[model samples]
Target chain A: MSISLPKAFNEFDEARQKGFIDVKELKEKGKNIVGTYCVFTPWEIILAADAIPISLCAMSDEPIPEAEKHLPRNLCPLIKSSYGFAITDTCPYFYFSDLIVGETTCDGKKKMYEYMNDIKPVHVMQLPQTTIGDDSYNLWRNEMVVLKERIEKEFNVEITDENLKQAIKARNEERRMLKKFYELGTLCPPPITGLEILKVLYGATFKTDKNEQNQTIDNMIKSVMEEYNNGVRKVSEDAPRILITGCPTGGATEKVIQIIEENGGAVVCFENCTGVKGNDTLVNEDIDPIDALTDKYLNVACSCISPNDNRIELLDRLVDEYKVDGVVDIVLQACHTYNVETYRIKKFLNENKNIPYMSIETDYSKSDIGQLQTRISAFIEML
Target chain B: MSISLPKAFNEFDEARQKGFIDVKELKEKGKNIVGTYCVFTPWEIILAADAIPISLCAMSDEPIPEAEKHLPRNLCPLIKSSYGFAITDTCPYFYFSDLIVGETTCDGKKKMYEYMNDIKPVHVMQLPQTTIGDDSYNLWRNEMVVLKERIEKEFNVEITDENLKQAIKARNEERRMLKKFYELGTLCPPPITGLEILKVLYGATFKTDKNEQNQTIDNMIKSVMEEYNNGVRKVSEDAPRILITGCPTGGATEKVIQIIEENGGAVVCFENCTGVKGNDTLVNEDIDPIDALTDKYLNVACSCISPNDNRIELLDRLVDEYKVDGVVDIVLQACHTYNVETYRIKKFLNENKNIPYMSIETDYSKSDIGQLQTRISAFIEML
Candidate 1:
């Protein structure tokens, strides 16, 4: 039985449809808008500074032609699209932001920030690539302090420790709610579709009110659990449950999910950058707010980090938790970190996990949609 | 006037010609042989344990075919060639090594090391991508300690703090001599060729005795200084002086340097991984030897590091000091970090430094030799 998405998801769709309306309204109320590209950006600090944080990582294939003029065509499509939106004046979020935050996540995006500076005021956070070292924590903690100071100076607002504590509480609540939302995917014949869940998760990045998002997620979880208890399934019980991992697939680029679902594969969980992995861990509430934020953000493992054992561990845990039948590793073309890592991920899954794996290397174009569909269909058939 | 290389350089060449003979002799004498890939590997710790540290980064076009069997054909040729040497049993250095050390400098090499463990005992050091972080220092320091212990255990010897300090002293002496050797290249008409300097630097990686290497460099510096006093010129005084920087170009890969020289561009300095920059800084003896080694190794400025400002600073200083008219940034194909970084390097040189810059992306094969020569010729003519 195919179950319908809860009404709360419709509310999220409406908010996304009215693009940048909330941000524009907030801007009119004199709120500082901070644009960020990665989840590594500390959203709690922006909230503490009484500034609005919006993810500026674009998901459109349209603006790529414009970005190709500035960047090489062989770069990750996500970067190209995001940059394309910036240069073409297509992303309202980019235009509305008072300041844009960038981090040294990867070489392409790191240097791309220099070009981004030409378009907008950019604050770069020098991120350490290894998490095991003491220097990484200290440096990131100092960076968080610097970010706090910069945000305060830029917005002319003092972000006191008390304010940071309150922000941490609010953000941790969101994380808790998100965790509940994803846990519902663990149910057999998962009541909610991956695309529906992805929409809600991606929409949260730009959602203005944390409390409202928490309420919506709470309602959706309740409704999904109710449906699951009623034995209502959005996907067939026998459908191949796949765990999608590698590279962030956000915005309208849900073609991978759409193709998989249409071809008898139910995406039970996404292990990508923009997935639940981004917010699965909570900030230590007992520690200094800055250190808490530093520890939490540093733990979000990206392929950019050396010996990213955390990412692998998370993937392994999710596979077992979600009852995944197969793994679909989708990497955006030219994303060297993820592309090269596919070899190891495939080997690990096949050898240790005893799970079937398929790798799909694609770009932000519909040209490969047919090919992707065929490959994913074949994979699901095997499952 | 045409100038021949000094007699000391010839002697250094003779030492290299007897390839792995010293290592074999040392092995017979019960000396432990350790292999490393990047400069970030703590040679001091290995030296402290009385092991012969040899750089096993290959620079051949031959073994790539063998490596392609294990790795993808489109991966970094440097990694493929290195791994190829291992699988094919062509590199005597790799065969002779009791332990081969690999660092997480790039995704290609990090994953490749896992496969390399099948051929030889591989020890992977998880290198932090950003040096500015406290975590990077702590992790690297811990890694150094671990390496020291591993070497000590492997060799059945104790690596005390005193041994580390003495090793640091000898390594610093080598650094001091290398500094003097490169300073000769800054002369208006450099007496020593770039190829000649690169040979000496590369040869030092496998040279068993630090004192012997230091003595050789000292004699070479004296000979070069004597040539400068006699007004000897290796290339035309009007030749466009160029600085080459990017990935490590070791082994037999002198195509880039040869192309530059043959195209009327005199390469005066290299800001690459295998160049003087890797050893330009000395460990601070005042601090704990481990911390000092940590600080020095963390400062190598590999492209793997995030927020690589040190690399830019090094390039800027070298451009001005070397009196370089042009900069050639050559990256092995699929080496993503340096490839993406070329844009920023180009922009910085053209806008800030007012120097002509050209980026060449090629592989180990000689197929691109003609194209490289044409481009270098054009760049030199423009200069």
Candidate 2:
């Protein structure tokens, strides 16, 4: 599945290098930027407070050596890389962030945030371990207020109801556009390669201009659909459709997807933080904005939530929707929540979804490319 | 540091094998038994429901191969062993349990409980990542009610206030007694070996009779103190006084203690779950039983908390109180919280306490004994 992507996809790809210049200019223009790490972050409040939110570059292996100086070598690469970037001033977005928002997503990331605080001002939201009971609801909802107030106090901006409503509308529209774009996998033969699809999705994080980012995604979807409708199939119908889940995957860990696709599998959908987990659910425009934000953000189904039945539920729907033939979980090394939850996920996919399931656990290091290739190639052969 | 103990310490040693028979007999006699894995479990509720509680035997490597069939290889060995025991019926204590109660204290254990629930009815209480907010208090307090209700319904019994008060009194006495026993480590040129102290502390979990457990602790404390007061110096006064912290260390992981003690170090305190983390705080008898239980259990400084200041505070106090010269943290392999936290713990002790802090990450495998001896021997020499 390889072809030159149209101008729209190229724009999305270049957004990363371009975002640095954009963010620098925005900073010079006195714009407020808040760096984030998880999908659970309520971006609506930051938008309402007139602040730009950046997903701190955490998926790469580049700064991991620096992070291992302060963090343990056995920790998740995402946390270490992110912290490394912060401490080393290696991530331009981090340098540009006026404030950083972190959620209690996992033990590794949460504790790393404590260390990150010395480098930058970090406001952490206490997330509930489960989405059941009144305590879970009130705790999360109150946390929205906490973040909102913190943003208000920090930026000297008032988040009025009108501002919130507009933020909600704009963000919801972007989510809907992204959701429709990713749903291109539902085609019997995907129009674009999985690698291209990932490039667009992963690059969306760096685009500071939300309006341009959404337009690029909308254009990419139309372009891909146009090619597919014209009888152009980049992915073969015989190729096994692979649904990737578990931890966030991009830079170093993307080797798993490359191996899967290279060995006769097309990664049709991603159920982890980088894919539908971030953009699948939309906030209700009718309810109070905070309540809407709380429900939507809490529903993202990170494995940190105990009895995270939502993840199982999402995976089930994803397999059916994408006509997935096999599931490949992209697990980051030392990610306890996802690593442990892999058992339940495997059992569920095996018994209920009737799909062959497999998981690959690797860190940010590229040392295991050969091993991942061997295992993933065999897995794809079986599929 | 080896001496034939009086009948009291001997009774504690026999309790493990003896407990299997006693637990079986109690099961035959139709006594309800509830199994727990952490100190955060509010035992008073189960006691009020007239059920015996046991720490489901988890600190071993024996059953881990069976667990690895379902769980990932790179998980905390404690979770793997516990899950293995439940699935294989290898642990007699697990076999006798009418119910199992697990708290979401850590990701590995919490997710493993979901699978264990399939083997036996398991109740999971959601634990907060922080103890700062009303949500932390209210959520934990409400969970106490939920657990109380679950116990009442499961056993067809009422948990009356009077029942709670009596349970609290009995449990508090046992806690105080155990606290007094472990505090003997504070005595310069300590009377008992660290392994001997661990034996009694770990063995106490198997004793189904709360009264007998408390009395054994009382008697053992009296015996050790009497010998120490009489100028019986088993431990060298010149040895480096060390404090043990981090994950539970008893079975395979206790090799850290052996290597340290074998090399000229006297472990003066254990700040981990198997030691002070279990018995340091007493439930407030004057407050509402649920609130008291919540406050006391929440105060136990597990590394699961976001800002685990309590652990640092406890470690700081323990170093001073134990008159400690060095700190050794026993980290279990893939135990993300403690492993990542080693950085903060090491930084704090160096900056504030002026002590050398080192952490050893091990599993239940004896393969690491040689490595541990080499590393721990060097650490002791540094002290």
Candidate 3:
């Protein structure tokens, strides 16, 4: 059965068609646009600094050719395409960005930021890899302070503790709404398809207005919950409930989701750097806002961190919560950290958790779609 | 003029001939042999626990084929060979190790440790990637504590503070002697060849007898200083004084050094992970030994760390102190961290110091020997 998207969801598509009309409108209204590469980039700080934060992670094959001129052909397609968008001037969000935020989450993106710096003002946030030490927390907090100072200096705005608290609250509400929206997937015959959820999550990255985004998420949640309560399922109940994990899969690289859905599998949850994992935790408001932000972000189980057992813990929690029958880990080409972590992930899933697992290594090209489909189909069959 | 080899140098070769006689003898004497991969693995802790610490970083092409059976073909040769040695039971040092220490310095090595675990008892140390944070220091110190406990449990020995202090002293003496030895290279027509220095450095990794090593170093230092005082240079003063940097170049991967020295360049200093940079700093004895060890190791400036400005600072000091003319950054294939940092290293050297820099990317294979020689020759010509 074909499902109709909500009006708010259609608005996002229309905005994309009109060259990200919302971002353009925000820029025209004298608001500073800050393009970010990872969720680790403090969006709350940008919001508090009276600037709009939009994720600039590209997922298109279109920009790879342009990006190859500046980068090695073997780099992650996400990085290459992102750089391509910047160099080729295909991304209006990047073109209109007053400042761009980059983090040292991975080497490929970290070095790519240097090149990105040539085209735009890039503020690099030096993220610490380990999360368990006081030194890491203090170092990360200091980095956040440095970032705040830079943002304030550039935007000429005071990001007071009160401002941060307000931003944190707004962001927390958005996260709560997102959490609720994802909960619908846990139902037998998930009410909302994985692709539909991806569209909403992807749209939130570029949407500047958190309140409007929350409202959109609420509407999506309402629609999905209604369907679930009415016993209207998007996919057959027997379809394999697959947990999607690994490197960030933005809107441009949702082929895995499409392939899974098309081949008798439904993605129940995403345990990746993007989507719910990025915004799952809320900043603790009781302590110093900076410390809270530092704690929350540092605890984010990015594979870039050593002893990333936290990621496995999160995956375990998600698997049980989403009732996942199998896991599909997609590692973008040249994403060394995620690629390496796949061994441990597979070991944990297959041996310990008794969940079926498959790792897919691919780039942002259509060449591997058929092969991926075959493998995914086999994985579903096993589940 | 040909330089006569020191008798002490012959002992290392003899030990190698006898299949790492020092390591074998230590094992025979009932001393627990702890094999390590990165400098980040605290040797002092192992020494404090009454265990002999030896580096297990392999740089041989022979075992790559064996390693490929368990690992991907595109992995770094160092990791592959290291694992190959473990799986194929080739290296005697690995065979004699009671426990192998692996640090998460890079993804390839980290994942390889999992496979190595199948063959031997592996203690994986979670290394922090940033040095700036209190959290990182605390995390690292705690890890050191954990390592100490593990060593103590395995060896049935209490590593007291006194023991740690004594270990630190012995290790510091080795560093000082090594430092003095490297200092001789600063002289015009440097007193020693880079290859000779590499031999001494590589030997130290597995040689547990600190006093003997120190004595050997003292004799070498005295000989080098005598040559320096006599105005007898190892290489012509006109030979390009080059500094080697980037990934650790163990004894098995000394091709770059040989290529540089054979072609008109004398390596005045090594700023890489394996040489002086790895053991340059002495742990502060005044403070808590664990804290001091944490500080020293964290400051090692491995490219694995984010915002690795310490590496640049160290390079600056080495260049000025050694009176270096150019830099040759050798990055092993599939070693992503150091590979990415080359861009920044090149940018920093060219823009800030005006130093001529060249990056050589190769594996532990003879295929690239001619290409590396040509590049080194060209780099020396430019200098």
Candidate 4:
């Protein structure tokens, strides 16, 4: 069955344009907007400091050529695109950001942050390469405090414990809603289209009003459940269910999702930064916010971490939850962590889950669309 | 003046074969051998544990195809080469090693270590990504101590403070001699060829006895000084003096040195791990051995560290001391840290020192040798 996206949520198509005006209006009203490139940044701290935290990671090829003028062409397209957008003044999020928070996640981003400092004020959190030691947590917690302090000083406001607690609660609530929104994929016929899930999830990041966004998610969930209850079988029950895992995907790499769908597969879940990797865990509200934030952020199973066991655990859960018949790992070109990690992930899924898996390395360019269509078609056929 | 390598110093060329035999003999005596892949490894601990620490990093392309069977092709050639050696059991150093120590310095090597652990007993040291924070140093010191404990447990021997102090003193003595030997390049018409210097340095790493290697370095230094005093000039006075920088180079990358000499340039110094980056700092005898080791190793000025200011400082001093007219930064393919940092290095050299700089990114494959020759020839000609 061919499922078309519902008409109401098409507003996500205009979210980017609307978000631009929202940020401009916020700036005009003397609001501080913080830009982040990785999920490692604890935006709750920024929120408590009375600042708006928005993602600045780019997912397009438009600005990559400008980034390659300084960066190597073989670099991950996401990194190049983000940099290109910053350098070319094309990203509204980057332009409106009063401060940019970065982390020492990988060699590429860590070194790139140095160059980025020349463009804007960049505060880098020294992230440890492994998450298995006491020193790692201690150092990470201290870095979180340092970031909070940096924001405090930047905004000339105090981020009291109460403010932090409130911010944590609100963010945690948003995570639950988003998690619930995406879990609609667990439905056998999958009430929603993969494109709709991605569009709404992406559009949510641009939202400044938390409770309003939460209500929006609440309304969408009810509508999707209602539609499914009223015999709206958007996706066929037998479509090969795929769980997309690896590097972040959205703007350009959305081609992967489109390819999977076009070739008789439903992208039941995203196990990457743009999805569950960013949404799976919530901050511990009872504990100290800094320590809670440290623990939560570090728990993200990024390939940047050595022996990234967390990624395997998450993939294991998502595979079963989504009833995935095949696992499709999407890696950005030159992303060493994810690329090298494909071996272990492939082994784990095959041995433990007994599910067929395929991994594809791609950049943001459209040149590989035909090849991808062919490869994904074969993969779906096997399923 | 065209000078040749002295007959006695030619023994350095045979060092690899001799070192292989030495490792076998040592193994026959039931001695433990600890292999390392980076300069950050605290080898003094291995020495204190009554074990041998030899560098296991591969600098040849012979095993890369075998490694590419499992690892990514677009990775640091050094990483692929090293893994190829380990998996194929082609490297004598790896074969002889009872245990291997690795560091989380870059993404490629860090992830590769996971696969290597499946083959041999590999212990990865979590190296912090930045050198600026107290947490970074604190975490590093803890990691150093952990390494000491791991070595102690592995060898079933006590690495006491006294034993560590003795090992530190011996290593420090060897470092001073090596420093003095390489300083010979400060001479206008360097008495020793770059090839001879590289041979001796690489060979000395395999020596079991520090005093013996120190004596060899001392003997080589005295011979060079004696030859220089007798008016021997191995290089022309007007040959463009070049400083080699960036990734570790030797074995496969010897082609770069050969090309430089074949062209109208003489490499006066190497600022990379194979040269000064590995040999530059001495452990402070006054501090605790573990603390001293951590401090010295952290100060290596590797591109893996963010805002690697130590590199610029070291480059400034070396450029002035070696009277370098140009810098040739040799980057191994897909080594993101060194490759991306090339921008900062080039800017610093051009703006601060008014020196010409060129960078070449090559893999372990000899396919690029002709291209390297052309680019380097043009660079040297301009210089």
lDDT scores of the candidates, listed in order: 0.82, 0.87, 0.81, 0.88
Candidate 3: give the clashing pairs. Answer: A133-B135, A134-B134, A134-B135, A135-B133, A135-B134, A135-B135, A135-B136, A136-B135, A136-B136
Q: Listing candidates in order, what is each one's chain A TM-score?
A: 0.96, 0.97, 0.96, 0.98
lDDT (10s digit) by residue, model 2, range A1-383? 22345666777767777899999999999999999999999989999988998888487888888888888888888888999899999888999999999988888888888889999999999988888877888999999999999999999989998899899999888888878888888888887777777877888888878787787677667767777888988889999999999998876777888888888889889888778998888889999888899899878788888779899889988999999999998788888889888878898999998999998889888799999988888888998
CAPRI grade of model 1: acceptable
Candidate 3, residues B1-383: lDDT per residue as tens digits? Answer: 22245666666545444447767777888988888888788889988888888878887889889877667676688888888888989899899999998887776776677668878999887776667656667767878888889999988999999999999998898888888877777888788888877777776665667797787778777766776777876788899898999988865568889989999789888888767777678899999999889888888888877667889899888888888899999888867778767878888889988999998888888888878877789888888
* RMSD of candidates 1 onward, in order: 4.1, 2.4, 4.6, 2.3
Ranking by lDDT: 4, 2, 1, 3
| Model 1 spans > 4 angstroms off | A1-17, A65-72, A87-89, A114-128, A131-146, A149-165, A217-234, A282-295, B1-17, B62-74, B84-90, B100-162, B179-184, B187-189, B214-234, B279-295
TM-score of each: 0.86, 0.96, 0.83, 0.98
lDDT of 3 at A286: 86
Residue B74 error for model 1, in Å?
5.0
True contacts kept of 3: 0.22
Stretches of model 2 off by over 4 angstroms after superposition:
A1-4, B1-7
Candidate 4 at A357: error in angstroms? Answer: 1.0
Better of 1 and 2 by lDDT: 2
Best by TM-score: 4
Write the residue-wise lDDT of candidate 4 on B1-383 in tens digits. Answer: 22233654566666777789989999999999999998999888888898999998898899999998889899999999999999999889899999999999999999999999999999999898888868778888999889888888888898899999988988889888888988888889888778777777776776776787776677767767777898978889999999999999888888999899899798889898888987889888898888899899888889998889999999999999999999999989999999999989999999999999999998777899889989999999999
Error of 3 at B134 (Å): 6.2
Given candidate 4, what's the lDDT at residue B193? 76
- How far is B55's C-alpha from truth in model 4 (Å)? 0.2
| Complex DockQ per candidate | 0.27, 0.74, 0.26, 0.86
Tens-digit lDDT track of model 4 for A1-383: 22233554776656777889999999999999999999999989999998999988888899999998888888999889999999999998899999999999988888888888999999999887888978888888899999989999999999999999999999999999999999999889799878778888877777788798887778888888877888988899999888989999888988999999988899889898888998899999999888899999988899999889999999888898889899999999999999999989999999999999999999998999999999999999998
Task: For candidate 4, list the clashing residue pairs, or say none.
Answer: none
